[model samples]
Target: MFSIFKTFFWLGWISFGGPAAHIGYFRHTFVDKLGWLDDQEYAQLVALSQFLPGPGSSQVGFAIGYQRQGLLGAILAFIGFTLPSVLIMLCLALLSHKFNQSPLFEGVVHGLKLLAVVVVADATWGMYKSFCKQKLTSGLCLLTAAALLLIPSISTQIILLLFAALIGCKYLASNQSNTHQRFTPSIWPLITFGLLIFALPLMTSGLPLIKLFSDFFQAGSLVFGGGHVVLPLLQNIVGEQISQDAFLTGYAAAQAVPGPMFTFATYIGYQLIPQAPIAGALVATLGVFLPGFLLLLGVLKHWQHLAHVPKVSGALNGVNAAVVGLLLSALYQPVFTSAVLNPSDLVFVLVGFYLLKQLQLPIISIVISFILLGVASNWIV
Candidate 1:
């Protein structure tokens, strides 16, 4: 457990460029170097994370830990992988007064924002090749992207996923099923998941922490896309409590941080309850992450069998394609639109994208380069 904690804690401090990059780093560290999980095993976990909601990469890390040393290992993994970013976000909340107007700090955020665009673009292409390989799957990806780009609402996303599932079941599902291990998944976790979905609302008024949990938990349960998708949901909920500037600041800081982007909640929580920020951070972080872990625990044992079932597998294929589309759309609106404001910013984005996809520079180097460029441009101007 200590080894697991130490390993992920180091990752937490330096695993930047968001969830996709973190996934890559995990693969290199655990799969390649440590030999903890084989490529297939790691891929399965990544697929599971993508299919479910809250903080996809974090859930993958948790699942890996669970496989290694059970529930306690999973808990330690979450802590190890999130603690650095959580601490950073909390500190940002505490010192917002000092840093809010710092131009250099603003430049770092700006650089990170552009880096986000590049990262998402790279992820979109990689997922496209991996998940959208088949003709029908690729078409589904395009259709989902178009629909989301045009409609641009949470309802549209949900409706498209449902429709895609139906289409997948009807067309892509095969009659022949593959053989896999026979293991029954426990029902208790499923029950707990449903219970919380229902019970959190009813209990929200009882305690402030309960309300906080309810909000973050609900966001976790609903978010299908990943880290960036959490932004809108969180913005709506936390926007009620903090200034728009503060909320945006947290989101930007989250992009630069080395761990789970969901730690953005840590910043929000601290800001919301400055008097007891640690408690606030704990509840909010746990609430947002709880649903995904519960879902994983409930389903992991049965995943092999489920993956072989034609109808279910077909639907998952559709979901995977849709995931690509969701990432594509997110790459544009909030990410590209919010950043890449001027021609100079555009130059940075193009260069960053080239460096990421073509030159294949390390993300840390790219981040550093952008930060320097941002500061230089700001100062020179």
Candidate 2:
């Protein structure tokens, strides 16, 4: 438990750039360094998280914890990995004005975004080789990338996954059948998930605390694509209750902080119930994240079993390819186009990529280097 907490605690503090970047970081730490699981297992988890409606990266972390030490470990993982960002976001909500004019802070945030570009690039290449080894799979990856690039939206992304799954089921499945026992998952987690979906709505009109929980839980249950996707849902859900400024402030703070972007809930919670801020923060954060955990628990065991089946495995392969393409589109538009505005920024990314890929600098060292670069770039420009 201590080890699990320690690992994810550090991860939460430094996981920036959003879910795709978190996937890269987790792959490096757990799959490469620790050898806890191979590339295949990790890819399946990524695909599963994307299919589920919640914070994709947090679900990945929760699944990792569950794989390591069962339910308790999953809880510890979510708490440790989410706590740092939750605190940062809450503090940001409290001190929104203080951060408005810090070039240094902006530099660091931009630098982290650049780091995400490098990390995602590396992850995409690695996954391509692993999951897209076949001609059909490679075509699916490139085609999905092209489709999403042409029409980029959450709906398009989901449709692409479904289309890819259809291709996988029809064309990619092999006749090879290995005897593997099916793992029956507990029905209780699914029941609880359904109950919360039903019960939380009823509770939304009661106490402030209950209303807060319901609102966040609904947000967690409904939002797709995670990260920035939560912003609008949050804005719409809490817009009438909190000032628009407070809601926007929390969204901004969420980007600056590390870990899952859903920690923005902490800021909204703190703002809504300032008298009992800690309780507010805890309930809101937990409420928003709980559904993802429940869904992960309910699906993971069964998914693992299904992943080995020839037909199902084909569909997962397609899903995995689509995941890589999604990362690719994200890397280009948001991470690249948004951050790399000038030649100097491009040079920095190239250098950073070389160091990470060829020279293999430690992620911490790379992060620090980019931070300094970001700070220096601000002065130089």
> Which one wins on TM-score?
2
Model 1, position 24, has a per-residue lDDT of 59
lDDT of each: 0.79, 0.84
**1-381 in candidate 2: lDDT tens per residue?**
799999999888778888878998898889877888998899889988888889999999999999999999988988899989987876777777688458888888888778788887888888888888888888888888888789988899889999888889888875768449686776888899888888867866658888888888888988788878888777877768787877776787787778998998888888788788878888888888888888888878677677778888788878888888887887787767767878888888899999998898888899899889988888676
Per residue, candidate 1 scores C-alpha lDDT tens digits across 1-381 of: 799999899888767667756775677568756999875466557667866777888999998889889889998998999999898888877777577457887676677667767766766776677777788888888898899889987678777777777787777776775665565786998899999999869977757888888899999898776788888888888866889888888887787667898998888877777668789988898888889889988987677787777786677667767767776776777668877789999999889888876787875688789888878877776
lDDT value for model 1: 0.79
Q: How many clashes in each candidate?
A: 0, 0
Clashes in model 1: which pairs?
none
Could you tell me the lDDT of residue 135 within candidate 1?
Answer: 88
Screening candidate 2 with a backbone cut-off below 3 angstroms (N, C-alpha, C), the clashing residue pairs are none
Which RMSD values do the candidates have, in order? 4.3, 1.6
Off by over 4 Å in 1: 1-53, 64-73, 174-176, 180-184, 194-261, 271-275, 357-359
